[model samples]
Target: MQNTSHLLMIRPVKFSFNEQTAVNNAFQQNDTNNNVAEMAAREFDAFAQKLQANGVDVTIVEDTPEPYTPDSIFPNNWISFHEDGNIILYPMFAVNRRAERKPHVLKAIEKKFRIQNKIDLTALEANHQFLEGTGSMVLDRDHKIAYACLSPRTHMSALNNFAEKTGFTTVAFHANDRNGLPIYHTNVMMCVADQFVVVCMESITDENEKKLVRDAIHKTDKSIILISFHQMEHFAGNMLQVQNNRGEKLLIMSTQAYESLTADQIKILENYNRIIHSSLNTIETNGGGSARCMLAEVFLPVQQTQ
Candidate 1:
């Protein structure tokens, strides 16, 4: 299946801004007066409810409070589940973020699906190289392509290694924000779905690189929906397309991101799938991620019961 009806979400116990990530992630803002954790929890619940209402099979797990994983809500940054029953663990740039990858979480998931083999790339962190799971690379699953933007959190070596392991062709490029700073995560600038791709063309400043990315998307036979850098700031490009139990396609995004889109853009997207948005202001404002980041699609095969 191109899109999965099953998804995994991590409910935050101590959701707050990460100082380590804030250094390069321009989207994050630290506000002292607000109760970030409380507000984030409310937002997470609402978002999960929204997904459920849209027919998504959301598996929500609460993060443990002991380790204080502030950005635990964004589970897509640490682990990715595959259809072939492979669970890949990624190396994170932040020290605290590494704690987000816990064995207990995998244990919880194993109760529902079969996890045949595991790939641990955490050893690369010792070399000061990191690849923050789906945050660093957006997979075009059907076409077997991995789109990655080079940054501190996404290195060439790591991308190549991931491709070698997963049998995905790597399309690497450098993407920058409006201010010319490298975009911290590839998913922040682009999202690849089954039938469409939403991207910030302006972020790929190099003309040759821009053409290469555009050409690659064309080869995938997906309709390209381009968002400007301004819209990208609102997390417009961070949207994800997924399927529900009824086999209906739904494009998910934050309310902030939905409000940023043009009427024409919305019309184009609606042609392919219904658009769903939930208010995630607190999480997006403080954690530097949105609806897509909170969801880790579960593609593992269900275990057969005799």
Candidate 2:
């Protein structure tokens, strides 16, 4: 239940470095490449093509040029699709990111999927509290548990609201990078797969919270594949496990993230699912998000046709 064959991705129109997100997101860097937009678009197309070749149903949505939303490539942060016929819109911390949530995107998807209700949490942004969708919390759908790390972009108020509405229990923790700064997003520090969990245990500075997270994952019937802070820095923990059309499991990540994994770790992951990777240096450097962020899994039921 954690993986879905349908993925939603927004093609970048003005994919450039976002200064607002860079304030706390340590993963972002200044744009060094000249043709970043062209390079990122090519990378996005190639990534989507690779996923399609492997049997994943990808929905590509073209971003508008007039609004100039630089971080539009990471659509998973603003919205999430649920198997319970629900579409949740989250509160974004960055002002520009608010524009990334468009009604047309939902309308386009509603043609194929049956959405019963919409949960709009965007109003929380007025209170300066935010939870950037799946970026802030990693949900174990099968277990009905939500794992979240406290950060500027992730607030407990929004998290509690989500939990209350979705009937999901929360396991909150404080996580930091090697520099002792708060980890901007929970997905960047850990990922919950169907059969296994890829996480940087070193990121949790609190021993009690670390034990809590470990206990929760252990209780969920998943094998733990631990990565180091160094590997996490390279986005190794940002992987997502998804199923192809044939119901085969595929662990998806960027080439840089895949290369950062140790042989033992790779072997462990490969034991559960086939590894799929694509080159995303241009996107990673500027967007500060990799394979997982680009994908918003669609778990809603398909509308039956006559």
Candidate 3:
């Protein structure tokens, strides 16, 4: 299936602006007026309901309170479920995020879907290397390509390891934030969909690297929608393509990202799929993640009804 209607979202018990992640993620802001954790819960609830109402099969799980992992809501960072019955656990840069990986979550998922193999990359974190799953690498599943940008949170060794295990060819580049610091996550600057790739090509300053990435996308027959750095900062590239229960293609994003689009951009995207966005001001302001981060698509086969 090209699009997965099933999505996994973590209902945060203690969601707050993560200071550790903020060092690299410029999108986050610390707000004192808003009760951040409570606000996040409400936003999450609404987001989940919105998705469900749109005919998406949403699985909402409450985060365990004991660990106090604030960023646990972004489960796509620590784990990814593949259509091939493969589950990948990735290495996280933040120490607290490492705790987000829970065996119990896997157990919970296994009850609903079969897992044929498990690939663990968390051990690389011990060596101070990290690759925060989908956040770090945007998978072009149809083309067997992993589009990644090098950053502190995305180590080359870990990327290579993932490519080898997943049988994906990697198109890697260096991406920087406004101040020239490495962008925290690749998904923040680019998204690879089945027929198109949304990217901030200007962020890859080196001509050779930019050409390589452009060529890779071209080879896969994907039309490129390039965004400016300012637009990327607005979370324009952080979009996910999903399917509804009726198998209708929907493009999911934050309201901010939706508004950031130019009329032409929207027209281009509408040609491929329907747009679905929610106001995630609270989530994006404090969580440093948008709609793509909030959804961890579950590609495992549906379990038989007993």
Give the candidate number with the greatest lDDT: 2
* Local accuracy of candidate 3 as per-residue lDDT tens digits, 1-306: 446998988889988888888877888888785688888788888889989999999887889997889998899999999999898999998888888887677777877888888899889988988999999999888778888999989999999999989899998899887788788899999988778889999989889999999999899888999998888888998999999999898999988999999999999999999999988888888878899999898998878888
lDDT of 1 by residue, 1-306 (tens): 568999999999888889989998999999684688898999899999999988999988889997878988999999999999999999899999999887778888998899999999989999988999999999999988999999999999988889899999999999998788999999988999888899998899999999999999999888888999889999998889999889999999999999999999999999999999999999999999998999999999987877
Candidate 1 lDDT score at position 5: 92
Q: Which candidate, 1 or 3, would have the higher TM-score against the true structure?
A: 1
Give TM-scores for every candidate, taking all chains together and pairing residue i with residue i.
Answer: 0.98, 0.99, 0.97
- Which pairs clash in the backbone of model 1? none
Q: How far is each candidate from the true structure, as Cα RMSD in Å?
A: 0.9, 0.7, 1.1
Predicted structure 1: clash tally: 0
lDDT of each: 0.91, 0.93, 0.89
lDDT of 2: 0.93
Candidate numbers, best TM-score first, in rank order: 2, 1, 3
Window of ten residues with lowest summed lDDT in model 2: 101-110
What TM-score, to 2 decimals, does candidate 3 have? Answer: 0.97
- Please report how far candidate 3 places residue 105 from its true position, in Å: 1.9
